[model samples]
Structure formats: C-alpha cells, structure tokens
Target: MFSRLFDALQGGSGVGAAVRRRQVDAEVPNFAEADDVRAAFFSSALQHAKSSYDAERDGYVWGRTLRPSYALQLHPLNTVQTYTQKKEFVWVGLTAGPWFVGVVVLQFNYFAAFSVSLYNVESEESWRATSRVPLPGPWLGGQWVPNEKGEFGPTSAGHRVEFSAPLSTHRARLCFAGRSVQVDATGVVAQQLPNGKSAGAQRYEVHAVATLPEEFLGVVFPLGPRRAALVSKVAAAPLQSPLKLRLGGTEWSGDGYLSMDYTRGLLRRETRWHWASATAPAGYGFHLSEGAYDVDNKSVENTFYAGGRAVLLETRVEFHKVTAAAKVWTLTGDGIQLRFRHADAHDAALHVGVVKTDLYHAWGTFDGSIRVEGAMYKFDRVAGVLEDHYALW
Candidate 1:
C-alpha cells in the first residue's frame, strides 16, 4: 500500500532522518512575571485579531494560522528561537468570497528601538502603541529614518502620509477578537486615538492597518508547561490546545518586494505562499510550515508552501505530539485521523507569552480541515488521504 503509506509518512526511514533521531531535549520553559504577556496581531486593513496566535497554558501549545496565503507555525520549546526585527506585513486585500474588508495606512517610522506589539494573541487592552518620540515625521516635525528594515516616521516635505478619511471608507471592517482587545497599527498617525478603557471584550471602531506580517507572524514558539519556564503552572493550568484547523481552501493575491539574506541573519526572503484548494468533500490533508528558530542551527526550519511550491521542510523534522483532542468543539488530530471544523467564529484566546489566554477559539475556513499535533492511530482504515511534508522552523 505504497509501502504502508511510506511507513506511516516516513516513520519508516527517509522523511526526516528517523524523526530527527528522537527529539526530547524539551527545555525552553523559564517564563514568569505573569509570562510577560505582550500581544500583537495588527495585520490591519480593518482589524483582525481574536486569536491570530494564542498560547493556551496547561502543558503547552502556541498557535498561529494567518492566511493571506500562508503563515502557519507550531512550536514546542527546547531552546533556540530567533525572529530578529523581521517584519512581514503587506496588506491591501479587499475580497468578497472569503470576506476581507479594507483600510490600509502606512507610516510607522521608528519612534524608538521597537515596540508596537500585538504580533501574538490573547489580547489585554492597551492596543496601538508607538514610541521613540518625535511626532509628525511625514510633515509637521517629521523624523525617524530607515524604511526597508524597520523604523518609521519621516517625511519632511517628502510628502507621503495619507490614510484618508470619509469615515475611512465605510470605516473598514474585518474583525476577529480575543480579549481586552486593542488592535495596534500606531495612533492613526494623523487622527484617531483615545479609546482604551474597556477591558476583555470590545471590538469596534475597527479600521486599522500598516501591513507587514505573515511569515507565520514572523517568529513564534510555545511547547509545554505553559512555556516561559513552567509559567508557574499558568494560573493553575488547563491549557492543551495544539490541533484544530478549518483552513480556508485557497484564495490568492501578492504585491511583492520582500527580499534579503541579511548577509546571513537570513531573510533570504521569497514571499509567495498563494493558495487554491476550496476542498471539503470530507477532504482533509495538511502539512504546512514556517520557521525562525535556527538558534545557531539547533535545527527546525521546516519552511514549505504547497500548491505554490516552496519546499524547505527538513530542518530535521521532528514535531511529535500524537493525540490533541477536543470533542463537539470539533477537533481531532492523529488518532481521530486529523479533522477540524469551524469557519466563522470570533472571540479567541491562547497566549503563552505575556499570558492573556482564556482558553481559545478561532474559525474561518471553508473546509478541508485537519490540524495534527502528536497524532498516530492505525488499525482498520489506518488513516488514509496521506501525503506529508511538514516542517515549521
């Protein structure tokens, strides 16, 4: 049977050199101070963050599944993570079939070293913050350099700082909340600010963007024990969310201009993970990836994008979790033979960093579900629909 489905997708011999020879160093937990939770999910064009990525405590499981054409990450600590000033935002979407409202504004020209956070999930109020002090840099007292590698604000007669009004074109819309919401993109730059107060559930007045995020939200990691080093049992633990994905089949768009190698800091960028599936005749097949933790090459860059082709999977493949369940809530991985169901839900949670998780929930997939995390069950059917190649650096 195709070599027993290639020995259960290479548990056989050649699909990641014997599962990277049994990975089990498991040691990247030392988080405290309430886990230093500082969330981020500003892909703006009219808000979208109710669980762009969450870290549910209880053992461990960090999430990130943004789709503008790829950005899936699954990590389980062992030390060695790096996502150095690696910005990947480039929005301008306005779809219909999949519902993507619009409203993009760009001009965050460095205010300080860096900190407009929300590149994680599990909201906690205090949204849209930018520092470094210097104000009006695209005009009135504009200042702050570098544009291609971070640092914004700077236009001084260079003219260029327009996100227009008119209720910001229907006040843009594309929300997806998760807690003490705030959605950041930097104080509108010319107007809009002063709306924080509420805590935990308030998603309105949307419209906010500055693009550059999708390379799996740059760099994310969450393994076990509520990470950050035990997370002090994460407020009494209960976390265990690792599998469950609906995965909107395929929709496309690209506006290019993302390349680099940083001499080797590695951004040897390519940017183009376009999709086109739309399947769900009970369909289920997935092996996605994204990476940014070469921690001096300890290994794990399983970066690959199918259909649009971008295979890189083989950073020593070895992300074994095997069970991951969630009844009626609809989530079954490995044992249940991979399956996910949910396509338009909001109110998300799951933060293992700076911890602000309230369990978790995020859906927006037209079908074709299957999110595996520590899966393995073979008896009768022996799990069909197989075709694997997963690597998430």
Candidate 2:
C-alpha cells in the first residue's frame, strides 16, 4: 500500500515542468511592497474579519470577502482540497537551568515523524531519539483542531495539546514506550505584524513569550507538491518560559527560553535555511533566519523581540564553517554576529528512492551583539541552535 501510494504521488510526468511553471507564477512579492500591503490588508482583517471555517477551502476564512487565512492565520489546514500539497507540524523548544529539550510532531502525507532531544547547557551533553510511523491513508495521521475563536492550535489523544480560557495556558503531551514529555505554558503577545497578503490568503505575524512550568515527561515527535515542491509557511515566536524536565530517570529545572513554530504549506523539492534563537538575558529574546522559503529578505521572521516590542532589522547573514567537521562555525549578518561551537550534534540522512533528507542540528551559544532599533544588545554567550537542512521528497 505504501509503495503504491508513493508511486501514485511520484510517478506523474511533467512534475518538474509544473513546478517550474508555478515558480514563475508564484514570484515572491517585492520587499518594498510588503510593508504597505501588510498594513493595509492585515489591519482591516484583524479589526473586522469574522473567523469561520470554509470546508470547501479546508481552513478558516476571514473578512468580508471570506479570504482564506491558511497562509497567515496561526491555525492548521489539514483538510486542504489538494491533499498532496498539505503539510503541517508543531515544534516546541524548552531551555531551562542546565538542560534544553526539543520536541516535535510532523505529518507529511506518506509518513509522520516524532523526535525528542535533551541537552545539557553547561556540558553540552545531549541525547536524541526519533520514531517514524508510515501513514498511508486519506486522513493522514494526527489532528489539528482550532479554538472556539478559530485560531490555529493543537489537540490530540495519547499525545495531546490543550488550552485554557483566553488562550492563556498552552499545554501538550507526548507518550511512547511508557515514557512521556509534556509542556504547560502561557503566552503573552508581544508584537503583531502583517506576514503578507496574497491573492489566495492574508497572513500576519505575532511575537510572544510563553511561560512554562518548572518541569514534565513523555516523548514524541512540509512543503511543496511533487512530494517536495511545496512551501511550508511558518509563524514563529521566541519564548520566555520556565521549564522542569525529566528524561531517563534524570530531572532538571530552571528558568528557560522556548519558541513555538506553527507551519502549514507545500514545500519544494530542495530547500535550505539558517535559523537561530536564544534567551540572551532573563526577559529578552533574539531570533534570526535567512531561508530560500521566505518570500524575500524582508520577512517579519527576521527580527528581534525585546521588552515586548520587535525591532525589524536589515540583515544579511552568512555562515562560515571553520572546519571540515562542521562542528565550529561563525554566523554574521547585518547588525548581528555570533559564533557557534557545537558541543554535541545530530546528523541524519534518509533516502527512500525519490525522497531524501540530510539534516544537521547543533545546540550552541552566540557570542556577539545584535543591533535593534539603533541600539546594540551584546552577549558574551547565549543559548541557541544552529541547523543545516536539505530535503527532497
């Protein structure tokens, strides 16, 4: 059944040709136009848009014309009519005391992958594990249910996500092999901006810091058609949360930094990006990304959040690896500079004929400064992750 499904999705002719055609049709909007469009489109929608699900569109539709928010809203669109173009996931990162734990649950049409990692901040000792479940059905795998307000959130059984009134507390759990990992958090909205407004949908961005409980256990864990030609739109926020973690009979607790990434889209066959986020001080957050998937360099994702405000920067970031081993590297960008020396790293290469992924993830620190709002915020050492990823599916 899996083989046949793969053949059905991958066997068609002119897939590459179709992708090229779409690339031309979907030229990214110019950076100069992005700000004006976002302000005009999102401000109106946020004020007057009524949120309602469009079964025909397979996601929430907002505003007078009933614009689809699949591209912008922080909700899941699992019921998209184009089954092959749908991909969705929720990623959470927790850093507290001497430990950092990362958890994720991802669903592509052909399979679902769950991963958990525990890292020690001081020593850089890390343990990571992953499990893959082949999914060969029209329903795909898990569920992503929206709130009463039609906002994108997660809820699942066995492994579940929940929320409290006014969307204050966001909670999640993953259970496998009689062990569990859980997150109990509360988010404070910092800044909200327009992500982009397109003919198909209107999108916006939000920055927040989610506060988490000191400690919890269980473990669990994209774009384009052609099985790889889609783009996964993302809304990510750096977090100010506390954490208490228990894994493999060991426990640790401390004030931590967390980040949430909510994504939905179809991805292209080949993709690359640079991503890093950190809790530089007790209440300040730093995040930066440069990726092929972004509409352009002006993506709101490239900014810093401090004191509940965001400072958008004009950044040109480059990564220079100092060694062939790729364990030590320097990342530099306009108004930003950092060095990452991987204490421990994870490398995975998976290929199944037409599908391929090569991913390297390193947890490290940034020793530099970021200029925000014409002011420089310096850091001798700050905790974060550096990732080099490539995928063709």
Candidate 3:
C-alpha cells in the first residue's frame, strides 16, 4: 500500500492520483502591508478549491489523507499573514528586555464572534476585537478591536459550516455570554516563534490555556443548536502535544494539531522528515533530525500547521540515534546513546482503551549557554511508544 502511494506521489498523474503542486503567488511580498501582521491587505482571506477528496467521493482503503494547518484551507486567505495591533500598555521586568506577544482570536459563525489573536506580551497591555472580514465559508479576523458582542450563529453555506482558528504565540480573553463566549482575550500564554533562517521550518513558543466557562464546557463545535451537542469521549484538561524535542543548546517544542478530525481518528500516516544541521553566529553548531511517522500504524498522517503554512512529510521516518541497533520494533531507528540523561525531560503520553502504549519521545531544552545537542541527558517516565510491526491504531 505504501509502495503504491509512494509511487503515486512520486509520478502518478491521474484524476484520482495525488498531484503535488505548490503554486506560490508570484506577487511581490507586501512587506509594508502583511509586514506588520504580514497582511498585504486589511483582509484575512478565505481560500477554497474544489477537489475530489471531499467526503462525498466516498470509500477508500489505500486512500487515506491528512490535513496539517487549517490556515492553509482558508477561503480567500491572505497569501501572507498580516497582524494589526491595538495597544494597551503593560509593564514588564525591563530587566528581561522587551517581550513580543501576538494574539489572533478567530470568530467563526458570528459576523464578529471570536478571533485568534497574538499580542506581544511586553508590547501591549490589552485589546478587544469585534466584527470580521467579509469572506466565504468562514469569517476572517483581521486586526482585533475592543468589543464583546457582535453576532453569533452558524454559517449559511460552505464545506465547513462551523469555524475555528489557529493560535501560536498568542492568547485569548473570552467568556460565555448567555450561550456564546466574548472575545476579551488577555490571559493567553506567550507563543514562541522560530527564527526561520535556521535548518528547520517551524519556530514559535506558545502555551495554550483555555477558559471554558460552565456553559461552554459541554458545547461542541459548529454553532447550530442541533450540531452543538455534548461530546461523548471526555478527556482531561491539558492534553499535551504528542511531540516536542530539544537539542544542542537550543530547544524545539512541537504541537502538530489537526482541528477537524471528523471521525475522531488518530491514525496518522502521511508526513515528512527533516534533517537540519545549523551553526549559530558562534561556531557552536547543532544537528536537528526529526519527522513524523506512522509509528503507531494508525494508517493516517501526522503533521503541523504553523504561521499558516502546511508541512506534510512522508510517514515512516527512520531515526538512528544509536549507530548499531539489532532492529527497531515499533521504533524505526534508535538513539545511539543507549541511555542518557533527560535532565529537562517532560512526559506527554496517550492512553487508548484497555491497553497503554508508548511513543518515541525525548528532547532537551537548550538556552545557547553550552553545547546541548547530543549532549548527554537522561529521561524519566516516557509516554506513547507503541511497539508493533507497523501500526496498530
């Protein structure tokens, strides 16, 4: 099956065959416009394209797919991310220097309901937003303004009758009003961003904290009364990301989330692997080799969407942390360092049904104070490393 799809993605050209085409708009980057929030225009565009992949296309066995970032599927979405800020001064330690925090509160369904906002923690004090950009499918949130109530309701038409937005290095100030929540985002955690010019692609620091008022806790997505029913499978708060890593005096935190998983499936198969070896201004360099694979054999895909960019790596990554390993059971490759110190290690585990599983996860946080990558580190109780021939999800 993988051989077939791999061959298809490699060269197969047909209506049903997967076709990879990256159409980067040739227009000059409007640094002046999208430069600030990176929006060349004041509008946050919604992008929509018709394809045979719709659910209506029906049954497929060897035909599974994955979606990375929702920002990529926006209708008339802005080619570049643009941020507009309304400042409310907030004091900082000053000793730590100025801090940057951005917030984007997305209001779906409502003419102006919610927005995903990014606020520079040290730069501003508070901001309120109302109203939305005139777009199709979902409403677009440009710059957040100060407001509580605008309009709330389901969309009239579109593939996604509901609304949801991504957040990175941003926070939210919201509370339920009667039935809807007000977008008064002020308590969101600070999001981190990658410097970009280095070896890997994603770089953002954000701590996600949600305040679900009593009324909203039972509520599900999709604004309509019939659709917004209580969810069946309840989980605990703070569902840590399945992946994150740190190395060589630098730390990399990852959260490859998929917002709209129709069937609530966790079978991730499609994704790519990246091997990055970068040197800082100082000669001290580091190597970052990471990627998502169907380690669990979910027959689905694992991916991430940051800054409105979608990155899909081929599933089944091979990691040879250790030079000599007899074989990799569930692990494609292994850490050459049989056992190391995970001094700053954190645990992110997932429990499914009657059995508990494990996932290959380890990382060290580096602050550029010393040689960190490959530096000897130890790990505590690990999580989610499923040992199977391929995948068992």
> Can you give the TM-score per candidate against the true fold?
0.21, 0.62, 0.23
Cand. 2 Cα-lDDT? 0.45
Once superposed on the true structure, which residue ranges of model 2 sit more than 4 Å away at CA?
1-83, 136-142, 148-242, 295-300
* Candidate-wise lDDT, in order: 0.21, 0.45, 0.21
The runs of at least 3 residues in candidate 3 whose Cα sits more than 4 Å from the true structure, single-residue gaps closed, are 1-53, 59-317, 322-341, 347-353, 365-393
Candidate 2 Cα deviation (angstroms), residue 23: 16
Candidate 2 residue-wise lDDT at 180: 22
Q: Report the backbone clash tally of model 3.
A: 88
TM-score top scorer: 2
How does model 1 fare in lDDT?
A: 0.21
Clash count (model 2, backbone only): 31
lDDT of 1 by residue, 309-341 (tens): 222233332222223532112222222222322
Worst 10 residues of 2 by lDDT: 216-225
Q: Judged by TM-score relative to the true structure, which candidate is superior, 1 or 2?
A: 2
